[model samples]
Target chain A: MTDPDRVNALDERAAQWALRVDAATLNPQDQAELDAWLAADPRHAGAFARAMAANAYFDRAVALGVDRDIPEVATGIPEVSAEAPRVSERRVMSRRLWLGGAAGAMAASLLVALGLDRLAGSTSLTADKGTVRRTALEDGSAVTLNAGTEVSVAMKPLERRISMLAGEANFDVAKDASRPFIVEAGPVRIRVVGTSFLVHLSELGEVAVIVREGRVEVQAKGTAPALLTAGDRMTVPAQGAITREQLSVGEVDRLGLWQRGEMDLTGLTLGDAARQYARYSDRRIVIDDPQVAGLKVAGVFSTSDPKGFAQAAALAHGLRLTERDDAVVLSRK
Target chain B: MSFSRERAVWLGRNVFPHEAALRQWLSARTASAGLEVDDVVQETYAILASIERVDHIRNARTYMFEVAKSVVLQSLRRARIVTIDVQANAQFLEIPEDAPTPERVAADRQELSQVSAAIAALPDRCREVFTMRKIQGLSQRQVAEALGIAESTVEKHMVKALAILTNAIGRGGNVRNASSSVREQRDDSETSDRSRPRERA
Candidate 1:
């Protein structure tokens, strides 16, 4: 998306077409159109040139206005309608033909109206580095604990309880009078009829419960029952059920990204983040030097490839690595 | 299909040495010489392991070369070293007394630079497809499955990239073939290479 084309689309074309162009993420076809427009006429080109020249490059407000409404322009897809189910040239040009004309509109309408939002729902249990997760329960209640995810499943009863085992699983209860949703871990019971809480468990020996939704009483291997609520979180240590302040939103998001096969680090050292990313990956990343280990990296990066990320750090900061038999050592390049 | 566990093992087995060797080869060719084999091997392993569906790579050797090729070219470009002869040295330095004006030549040069930059700026995925087709030589369908994109998308990126390049070249007036004499090296048995319409890179 060149400066001239962006201007031409923004100023000369209807606001609708501009929106579709932006949403396509710089697709080549869209790029071609912009090029053709720039090449075709001096006036069309100038109208774009003048509009861009006169305006400040899209202020945040105007940008937001454009961003928010851009999805709608895609609906002008003169293609087949849901009501008719016909695939003719008028309503159903191939992806190529449609790209030049009504395709953007058609794509936008369907994508905005359904696709983007729908894609978000089907995925379950995304995990991230060093962050926890919590969601509002349906009955004006909530569930909280360790899955750092951005944009998660819309909750329902049986559908709500996630099914998979990754690093850790946490559950906060919302007291429903009808159904009692108990988290199923072999023999360890953290029963919740309707309350607040947290449970953190991974593929390791580490398993703990933090209660933030309501009073979640714990029972396992002669461990005593503990009550927790909205303002509390417990770290199931090698010993006691330690509780802390109400889990913050950021911390919650960090825990959920893991399910998405990522690590959610806002501001953590390379070593700390590496340890979290170590779960999904088989190869181990060793922060050999304490000084280099102390280097803080921050972002919502994936954990699926720990070794890959270490390489990124090496390239970015010249942090070299010494490949050991079982571990990767990070040092000054 | 879920080669997550196997992906790491494959890295350590097939990819590690090959990539380490490429880096060694490149470093051998580079100003930064005498890098530790162990260290470069470690770094190369880490880089390869970073990608998604890396486990889907059946031929670790070819995959390593692909990644190595990208890394090497990028490093070479960054260091302003010519890995290949994209910029032919005008072949000779003979000067015509009535050669074109510097301004006219510069404008043409400026336009060419823009086109080159645009092509260079293409993302890893798009560039890989374009290079294989235009530079290294491959068919659209071959480029498609190799890069794991649709055939149509391969064409789309190709046509778009070509359109941009052609437009840019038209302005520049550098009428030379972009990658003359460059042939796509295919180790067909060594690699599950896609078919390509041959052209010089």
Candidate 2:
């Protein structure tokens, strides 16, 4: 056989396999046959790949919006087009179609009459000091704002954007491949199709992202985009090199404890832990000595109880703990 | 390695649109070299499909062109009759940066229309089966039941439709004999049970 003939035969076989694979789940026998065929030759795999790619290419034909009735040519087939129930609409139905559907127009008008359209637009949400706030967006994604956190959410047609204005927020993003969920925190930007993650913008302008599920792509100014999967933590400092660490399951759970009013101070310095406490309570954990403040503290403590935390820290370090009217002060003995 | 469905979709969205330009560039470079453009394209797609991840690829068009160029170079090196001029030309070949310009966007829109036209050009039965399966988003069984034909017959028409469309659209709708080729395949009996269209009671 000629080279062209051989290539065409390979492509033909590849197309057959491609259709079967894409159309439905293949039986074990067919799967084994396909595996053997692909392994038999490099060109076979390549042709199969090309065929699969072509199959995917035509999937976008749905974007053409062709809803015309297909005419029966010669077979005199029954008119099924009129009564054929659409199993599923491949793409996300346009918002216009939803509003134009039965009773949807009435509901939309009622929403507009009630001034609820403003809620659909950009809305600023703030969690007050010592209070965590949880709110569900219209797209079904939920956000849990840490104490003293502020975020402005704008759900556009193409993208769902959240600007982290002040502090930390844990987002359980809904799966929408067409519309990416993007969170902009200071100089860092986090983009994901659908995933749960924590975005924290510290008081010092340091941005930290921790992925709880799926994957997220993070881009910081002047840095290459970093892809973070589950149990990955990345910290972008205000003016320093970015640091990425893979957390253990326990560590990820500890990081997410903020949503439950618990502070994980396992690896935090006394000074840093005190700062964390300040976000949750007005009563401060104050340490006057820099040496004492620099000492590391490790434990899970209630975020609202700074006095108890200071006492425990002082006891552990053999330091003096003085309880003032508004502040619990820890000092080096 | 095999290509995942997600990777295939990524190639379809990012790499497939640039096939016309890739073919044009390949033919221009390989015309004198006597290397088959289709052979190089298939090999390029093979390389693209075998890659583990696509997130690192910032520009897929540039990446695809570079892959095609490498395929051409590999073919030239392997050829028994070595041409010095073709080798040098392949080495100096520069791929234009496919920045998403207004013209590029218009070209992409034109590609979608080409897809519509390709579907329109399919044979009567083949077009109906493809439209129901792809455009109307129906299952093979649903399409068979709707058209009152055997499920296997529906599958056959789909395979033929896919082959014709893949060739037509992948090569910029230049397959003038697409319908004739499909008709030829339709006549060829692959399976005695499945090839003959059985009417559903």
By DockQ, the best candidate is 2
List the TM values for chain B, per candidate.
0.31, 0.77
Cα lDDT tens digits for candidate 1, B53-171: 44334444544443433333322222233423531222211111222222222124343343345455444344455466655457767878876767766655553433333222322
The stretch of ten residues in a row with the least summed lDDT in candidate 1 chain A is A92-101
DockQ, candidate 2, vs. native dimer: 0.10
- How far residue A234's Cα lies from its native spot in candidate 2, in Å, is 34
The candidate that achieves the highest TM-score relative to the unseen native structure: 2
For model 1, the stretches where C-alpha displacement exceeds 4 angstroms are A1-57, A60-167, A170-179, A184-188, A193-198, A202-232, A236-238, A321-329, B1-201
lDDT of 1 by residue, A1-333 (tens): 221101111122412222223223447787677657643422233222212211111211122222222121122233211121121121100111101111111211111111111222334545454333333434433333343423233445443443334445544344565655555333345556765344565444345555433466555546676655544555544445444456543344344334223454556888887776664444688987888989876444545445545655564456787777656678987
**Which lDDT values do the candidates have, in the order given?**
0.39, 0.66
Worst 10-residue stretch by lDDT in candidate 2 chain B?
Answer: B192-201
